[model samples]
Target: MFIKDYISKDYPAFNASDSIEVANEVAKEFGYSHVFIKKKGFYLGALSQQFLEESAEGTLATLEHHYEKFALLDDGNILDSIKLFHTFNSNVVPIINKLEKYQGYLSCDDVFCEFAKYPLFSENGALLIVQINNRSYSMTDVCRIVESNNGKIYGCYISAFIEDDVQITLKISSENLSSIDETFERYGYNVVLKYYDDEKEELLKDRFGFFQKYMEF
Candidate 1:
């Protein structure tokens, strides 16, 4: 989804001339570690709790010297926001318009929620990882095999690739994937990994845990 759809104005922003005390108050009130600083309508940067605590007696303008100018445009996608989250290790990211006007911020929760809604994660399905030669791979045959076995593909993604081989991860709607597995084997596709509901649940739990820990910065 587009970043603007999930942009939130709930988080507070401070004027460049505002005090670190004001920023700290707003952050504490909202349970945020950082707050955005703007000059007029344009975004200047962000001030973090650690920065504010270390340099308490300063204006937002002074804190601006230490702020990281991380932001995404209004038309950017969720992937773009995710990159920013990882790069800056921030819980929230500022969104700006074409004119560089601060629109709002996208929170970690919002991005995580959006990610959870993706078919690969949200759908009740089985995951199959297949290894295949890059030059010989054909998605048409893969779909045919699954469909022929009365299985429905909810989603699929390419995981990793080497020079000659690639790994493809498929999310299938059927719980019983024996026939599909046999079909792939019959067609000479090597099944590298498989995950059913129980295994997928554990895997996702660990993944989300890592995601939460990653966002804590």
Candidate 2:
């Protein structure tokens, strides 16, 4: 999804002439660590809670030295937003238009929710990690082998590409992976790791439950 689609315009923004007290109140009301600052419809920067609480008295423009300017353009996608969040260690990020006008802010929670909905993460399937020489790598053959064993591939992605080989991670709809694993090995593919709900149902159940609980928090 695009950043503009997920950004929330409901959040507040402060003017350069606004006071720290005003920014602090807005941040508290919105449960945000920082609030955006703008002047004459132009994006200025942000004011952090720490800066507002410690400053004696000053306008947002005067006391904005502590805040960093980080934002993504409207054309950027979810992956771009995620990278900025991790790079800056921020829970919320701003979005801007092509003209550099502030659009809105995106929260990490919302981005993560979108990510969890991806087929790679949302599907309940068997995961297999395999290594094969780059020269002999053929996704068609992999699919053929799995299909011959009555298995359906939910999704697959390349994990790594070394000098002479590549590592691939496949998500299969079938839980019974013994025959599939043997079949892959027979075709000269090395199975590095295999994960299926059938063999580790209890472990997966506990972990998934913990993840759900954590997300709720």
- Give me the candidate number with maximum TM-score: 1
RMSD values, in order shown = 9.3, 7.3
Which stretches in model 2 have alpha-carbon errors above 4 Å?
47-56, 132-145, 160-166, 186-189, 202-217
- The candidate that wins on lDDT is 1
Q: Each candidate's lDDT (Cα)? A: 0.84, 0.82
Residues 1-217 of candidate 1: C-alpha lDDT, one tens digit per residue: 8988988887767898888887887887876667898888888888777668777576888765687888899898978877777787778888999998999988888878888888878888788999889988888888888888888898887888978998888999865599899988887889999877777778999999999999998
- The true-versus-predicted C-alpha distance at residue 83 of model 2, in Å, is 0.5
| TM-score of candidate 2 to 2 decimals | 0.74
Q: List the residue pairs that clash in candidate 1.
A: none
TM-score of each: 0.79, 0.74
Q: Report lDDT (Cα) of residue 151, candidate 2.
A: 88
For model 2, state the Cα shift of residue 19 in Å.
Answer: 2.3
